[model samples]
Target: MQASGYSFKELLGFDIAVLSELFSSYTTLDATRHNELMLYFEGVNKAWNHPGFTFLYHYQQYVELDAEPYSYTRFFEHYRRKYPKEKGSMKLQHIAGEEMFVDFAGKKLQIVDKHTGEVIAVEVFVAILPCSQYTYIQACRSQKREDMISCCTAALRFYGGSPKGIVSDNLKSAVNRSSRYEADINRSFKDFARHYNCVINPTRSYAPQLFNIKTIYNI
Candidate 1:
């Protein structure tokens, strides 16, 4: 009933800017969801007369709407996050020759051991540049620690210059624990990183969709 009662308290104790952001960014109805939700809001808009009364009624209607089956709190947080987005600048130490994303995929090829007549399935590793699409590949027994270190050094030499940075997936040999925003780079990898004056960053486990390598020079 009184703006003075709440506004003064909110102004002093709460972040008005944050509250404004929360309210403004709130998605009234997700287009990806049911169309009925949209129609409900539109109906409230046309039916209501007074500004204060309409806003209050619509606010209640929004929460109470039977169409929204899931938790609205979760919906709000979901919309708040730009989940499928690339944020921050890629410090890009190398425009011409700096950083490379190195990784191994699960796919493997069967190698026929000439000496033993044994069928050995070998995993393939690839290091690539996001900008140039240039790639290097090697076949190894598995994605082991030694194999990782060897493959990276060979790939760099194969490319003709030492790259300034290396990006990798949170594989067992590379990362101990994987995080969406950050991951732990292993000790040996850190040594390799320090030797070359390069940085090693593992991709967030949450963001597996972004991982794909293409061979630009060959294609």
Candidate 2:
């Protein structure tokens, strides 16, 4: 919307955080061939008199029937299945020790090998609880499988328990093959998934509105 010179209105109530996240995620997206994506959202917003709540519910409920990719029937069926992310809200809500978001922080920070005094630029690994914003950080090598799994394990122990889901970016260490709905998870990640009794969902290649991927790509 920002790319099209559209402004975010404060009219009609919705979760401020959710709206902000949406804006921040899609603001920089290059328009489609005819700017159809942005145009569609704008039209929907205008029709609803710019009501936030109405726009959200419309997508989750009725707006899809006419559109491609996410047509009405598909949207209804998704809701009917009661998917956690689609059911009540678009955001992931952590149920205590039920989920964790882990990622490799860009712009490697220096972590010296104390024994050798080598200035090793170690990547920062982060884990955040969706519900509390409680997070932890550590330094690692690259986004390699061994490093990532180790970092995630440390994060889980830091949080004191394993969650039912471990949200990760669609990187080599986490995703084995890409897909729109269910991608093949990496072997190491799958092992961790089994050990921790968790499911892994890799972010779509370049889709926005994904809570973590949105910020990750933005950064």
Candidate 3:
């Protein structure tokens, strides 16, 4: 019980500044796991001399004191209330006849054969003009080069004209290789676009924000 030598704040085993910093950093992180949060906290606050568990204990105490009803779940609810995350708008402005977005729907549609009582699943191809919100849909047997080209031709015919550029997902039929900086367009698809006097613009791999027509058009 020799508390005379140690400072009162040191004896408490927690620093309010450190705890607040940890909480603020935790709010920005995508991971909700305590261990990951602790790792990130350690990496950021290297000057702080404390064990990981000790930091976690102080965090728990801070949460309980700051949040009402005193539980980890309640602490998150309280945190969210204090600092709400900002949502981004997905709406994009487009020029008329500038771009046409095309993609295959995630779900397949079923087609029943008239002669035989059998149902066949078909891929749904969707094309949309961002400016006019005009849409064209076609069901194809597969997303092969020929089918994809046919769909694009049909969509253009339905619209009565072709856009300056055709925005497409990185499907194998359209894109030979997908890349962040530049994608390799398939030869057949390239010829199809040239014939129609439109450029093929493939979206970046794994990035939906570039060509999220479904969400943008409310389709």
Q: How many residue pairs clash in each candidate?
A: 1, 3, 0
The lDDT of model 1 is 0.67
Model 2 stretches with alpha carbons more than 4 Å out = 1-94, 114-116, 208-219
In candidate 1, what residue range of length 10 has the lowest lDDT sum? 210-219
> In model 1, which runs have C-alpha deviations exceeding 4 angstroms?
1-94, 213-219
- Cα shift from native, residue 108, model 3 (Å): 0.4
Better of 1 and 3 by TM-score: 3
- Specify the highest-TM-score model's number: 3
* Displacement of the residue 89 alpha carbon in candidate 1, Å: 17
Per-residue lDDT, model 3, residue 156, is 95
* Residues forming the 10-long window of minimal summed lDDT in candidate 3: 47-56
Tens-place lDDT per residue, model 2, 1-219, is 556344556423548786676556555533452245444555544564332234345665434443444555554454444323333555445677667877765456777778999988777777777777778888777888988899988988888888888878777888888888888887878988899888886767676233442222322
Q: Please name the candidate that would achieve the greatest lDDT relative to the true structure.
A: 3
- Ranking the candidates on TM-score from highest down gives 3, 1, 2
- Clash count in backbone of candidate 3: 0
Winner on TM-score (2 vs 3): 3
Model 3 residue runs over 4 Å out of place are 1-86, 210-219
Q: List the candidates' TM-scores in order.
A: 0.53, 0.52, 0.58
